[model samples]
Target chain A: MNAITIEGIEKSYGKTVQALKGITLNIPQGEFFGLLGPNGAGKTTLISAIVGLVKPNAGEIRVMGCDIRKNPTEAKKYIGLSPQDININNYMPIGKIMEFQGGFYGVSVKESRRRAEELLKYFKLWDKRKAGRYQLSGGMQRRLMIARALMGKPKILILDEPTAGIDVELRHELWTFLKQLKEKGITILLTTHYIEEAERLCEKIGIIHQGKIIACESPLKLIEQHRLHEKAERSGAFQFVRSGSLEEVFVALTGRPIEEASKKSGEEKWEALPASLL
Target chain B: MGSTTRLAALVQMEFFRFWRLLRQTIVPPVLNTLLFILIFGFSLGSRIKEIHGFPFIVYIIPGLTAMGVMNNAFSNTSTSLHMAKFDRSLDNLLAAPLKPFEMVLALVTGGIARGLLIAILTLAVALPLLKQPLFSFWLTLYFVVMQSVFFGCWGIIGALRAKTWDNLATTQTFVITPLAYLAGVFYSVTILPPPWREISLFNPLFYMVDGTRYGVLGVHDAPLWISAGMITGLAILLFAVCVWLFQIGYKMVR
Candidate 1:
C-alpha cells in the first residue's frame, strides 16, 4: 500500500491567499522522497496539511489508507514530523520533554522511557538528558527535536529543513543517519532548499513551484530528459560536453535560477560543471 | 474512537507539564493568599468586629480562597498557552493524534489542578490563624473544585484569544482582577444600595465568592442553594463554550 496519498488537496490561509492549490501526489512505502522548492513554494503548507495542523479547504489525505479528516488519530499514528523551527520550552529538562512527547502519542511511560534512552544515546544527548532546554547548543537542540519526532517509531517521517543551520560535518552526520533510517524501511518525505542534499538522498524527486508540482521523476530520468531538451535547443556545434547537473535540469525546466545555487564556493562551482566536459 | 486515547494522553501530559513547573504554578498564589489573610483577615479584623454575625476574619477567608483559585487558574492556562505560541512548540502538539477537544481538556485540567493545589494549601495555612472554623468541610471542598473548573475554562478562553503575553495580562487586569475585587471579596454586598447590590448579583464571581463564604461561615448575602445553583450553571455554560471552541479548532489549535 502507498504510505501517503494526497488527492486534490486545496487550502487557503485567510480567504484570498491560496497556499496549496489542488496538489496531488502518492509516495510509495519505503521510498526516500524529496520535495524540492524555494521559499513560498507551498512546501511547508503541503506538509502542514498532511499532518493535520492546518485544515484544508477541500481535499483528502490518506496515510496507510486512513483518511486524515475522518480518522486523524489513526492516520497520525503512522506519521512523524520534524518541523523547521526548533522551539521547545526551555524551563523543562530534556528527559521530561521527551517523556511528554511520547505520552502525546499514547506510548506507555515505561516503554517511552526505555525508547527515549536509546534515542538520546543514539543522538549523543544522553549526558545532557537532565539539562534544561536553554543549556543545549543549536545543533544539539535540533537533534533533540528529531529525537522527539521519532518517539513513536512512525512509518512515515516528514522532515522540513532538518539541517538548515548545522555545520557541514554535522550535516553529513545527519545525512548518514537518515540514510541508515531509510535502510531500516522508514519512508521519508523531505523538503529542502539544498539541491545537493536532495540529489544525494532521494530516489524520486518532485519540484514544486507556486503551489503546484511542476515536475516529478526519478533523478536519472529527469537528468536524461533535460539533456535531450538541451541538445535539441542548441543549433551550432557545442564546444562544451553534453551533460546536465540537477541544477541545470531544474533551471532548464523552471526557467528560474535556484536561489541557493549562488552561494556555492568557487571550487564547488567548477566541480558542478558537466562530468562529460571534465 | 482513537480520539479518546489521544485525549487521555494529552491530559496526562498536561499534568506532567504542570508538575514540572510546580514552583511557578503553585507557590506564588499560596503565599499571596497567606499574606492577604495575615494583613486583611488578622490585622484588620481587630478593628472590625462582625459583618452579619460572622467574625470579619472568618467571612473573608472563603472569598480570598476563591480569589486565589481564580487567579491561579487564569494564570496557569494563559501563561502556558501563550508560551506555547511564543516558543512555537504548539506545532508539535497540534501535529499529534490529539483532537482540539483533547487539547482544551488537557490545558483546562492542568489549570484546575494548579488552582486546587493553591486553594488547599492556603486553607491549610489559614486554619491556624483563624479562631473560628472557616467552613463545613464538605461544602468548602465542593466550592473549591467548582471554582477551579469554572476559572480554568475562562483561562483557556483568554489564552486562545490572546496574541501576546501583554494581551494575556490585559485580560487579567481589565476583566478578572476587577471582577474579583468587586465580587464582595472584602465587604458584604448586602450593605450596598439598591441597584448596586443587584449589579453585584449579575457578576458570576460574586456567586462563587458568596457561595464559598456560605460554605465557610454558613452565612451569606444570597441563599447557599442559589450560590451553588449559579456556580453549577456557570460551569456548564463555560464548559460548553470551551467544547464548541475546540470543535472548530478556534484560536487554541489554529
Candidate 2:
C-alpha cells in the first residue's frame, strides 16, 4: 500500500495563478521521497495539497488510504508536516509548544510529554525546553519544528525545506535526525534545494516544473539517464552545459539557473502569495 | 485523546499564551477599568451625583465591566488570529486533525475565558470598593458571556478578512469603539430625546450594557426578553459564521 496517493489535483489562486495543474503522484509506504522544483514551480503547493492545508479546486488525495477531503481527520492523523515556515507561536515556551502540537493530533498530555522528552533530548533541544523562541538559533528553531512534528508519532513525515537556513554542520545534524526517522519505518517526503542532500537522503526524487512533475525516479537513475553533457548556447534556452552533479541535472531539466533558495526562496514565494488574493 | 480533551488542550494553549504576556494582557485592562472607576465614575460622579436614581459612580461600573469584557474578548481572538495569518502559522492549525468546528470553538472558548476573567476581576475590585452587590448573578453572567461570544466570532471574521495590520485595526477603530461608546456606556439611553434614544436601540452593545446594568443595578431601559433574544441570536449567528469560514478556509487559503 502507498503512503500517499494524489490523483489529478489542481489549485488556482484567484483567476490568474494556477499553482498546480492536475498533479497525480504516489509514494509507496516507507519510501524516502524528495520533491524538487524552482521558485513558482508549485512544489510547496503540491506538498500543501497532500497535507490538506491548501484545498485543491479538483482532485482526490488519500493519506495512508484515508481520503484527505472526505476523511481529513483520519488522514491527518497519519501525516506530520514540517512546513517551510510553520511559524512557532513565539510567545509560548518550547516545552508547551511541543505538547500543544501533540494535543492537536489527539495525543494525551502524558503521552505528549513523554514523546516530547525523547524527541527533545534526541534533537539536543532538551536543555532549552523552557526557553523562549528568540533564545534558539536558526538551526535550533528548525530542529524544534521537526521535533514538534514528531509529537504526533505520525506514520508519514513530510518536511518542506527542513534544512533551509542552517549551517553545514547543523544541516548535517538534521540530516542525521531525518535519517533516524526514516530508519524507524517512517515514510519521509522531503523538499529541499540542496541537490546533494536529496541525492544522499532520498530513495526517489520528483522534479516539478510549472505545476507539473517533469521527472520522477531514483537519484542515480535520473542522473544516469540525463547524463549532463556540454551543450550549445541554444539547447532550447535556460539549459546549461552538462555537469555531472545532480544540481546540473536539475538546472538542465528546469532550464533555470540555480536559485538562491533554501534560506530565502521558498519562504519568499510563500509570502508572495498574498492573503488578499485568496 | 477524546474530542473534548483535544479541544481543551487547544484552548489551554491560548491561556498559556495570555499568561506569557500577563503584563500586557491582564494588567493593562484591569488597570484601565480601575482608572475609569476613578476618573469617570468618581471624579465625574462628584459633579453629577445621580443618573436614574443610582449614584453616578456606581451606575457606570457595569458598563465599564462590560466594556472590558467585550474589548478583551475581541482583541484576544482578533490579535491572535491576525498574527497567525500574518506569520503564516495558521497552516499548522489548519493541518491539524481537529475539525473546523473544533478549531472555531477552541478559539472562541479562549475569547470567552479571557472575557470572563476580566469581567470577574473587574467586578471583584469595583463592587467591593464601592460596596455594591450583583442584583442578579445569573443575568450578569449571561449578558457578559453573550457579548464575548458575539465579539469573539467577529474577531475571527476580521482577522481572516484583513490583509494588513492597519486593515485589522480599521474595524476596531471605526466600528466597535464608536458603537461601544454610544451604546449607553456613560449614561442611560432612555434619558436621550426621541430619535437619539431610538437610534441607540439599534446598537447591539446597547443591549449588552442595558442588560448588564439591569443585572447589576436592578434597572433597565429596554425589555429584558428583547435584549436576551437579540444577544443570543447575534452570538449564535456569528458563531455559525466563524465555523463556516473556518471550514471553507476563506481568506486563510487560496
lDDT tens per residue, model 2, A170-249: 88888887888899999999987677889899999988877888889998888777673434333543354346557666
TM for candidate 2 is 0.91
Chain A TM-score across all models, in listed order: 0.87, 0.88
* DockQ, model 1, C-alpha based: 0.46
Candidate 2: where are CA atoms >4 Å away?
A: A227-252, A255-278, B129-132
Q: What does fnat come to for each candidate?
A: 0.59, 0.72
Query: Judged by TM-score, which candidate is best?
Result: 2
- Quote the lDDT for A209 in model 2: 76
Chain B alone, candidate 1, TM-score of 0.91
Residue B68's lDDT in candidate 1:
94
Model 1: docking quality category? acceptable
Candidates 1 onward: DockQ, in order:
0.46, 0.56
lDDT of 1 by residue, B74-162 (tens): 88777777787778887788777766667877788887888888877877787765566755878877887788778888887887788
* Per-candidate alpha-carbon RMSD to the true structure: 6.5, 3.7
Runs with alpha carbons beyond 4 Å of true place in candidate 1: A232-242, A260-278, B1-13, B16-23, B132-134, B252-254
Best-fitting candidate, measured by lDDT?
A: 2
Which digits, one per residue and each the tens of the lDDT, describe model 1 over residues A2-70? 999999988887786777888999999999999988776788889988888778888899999999878
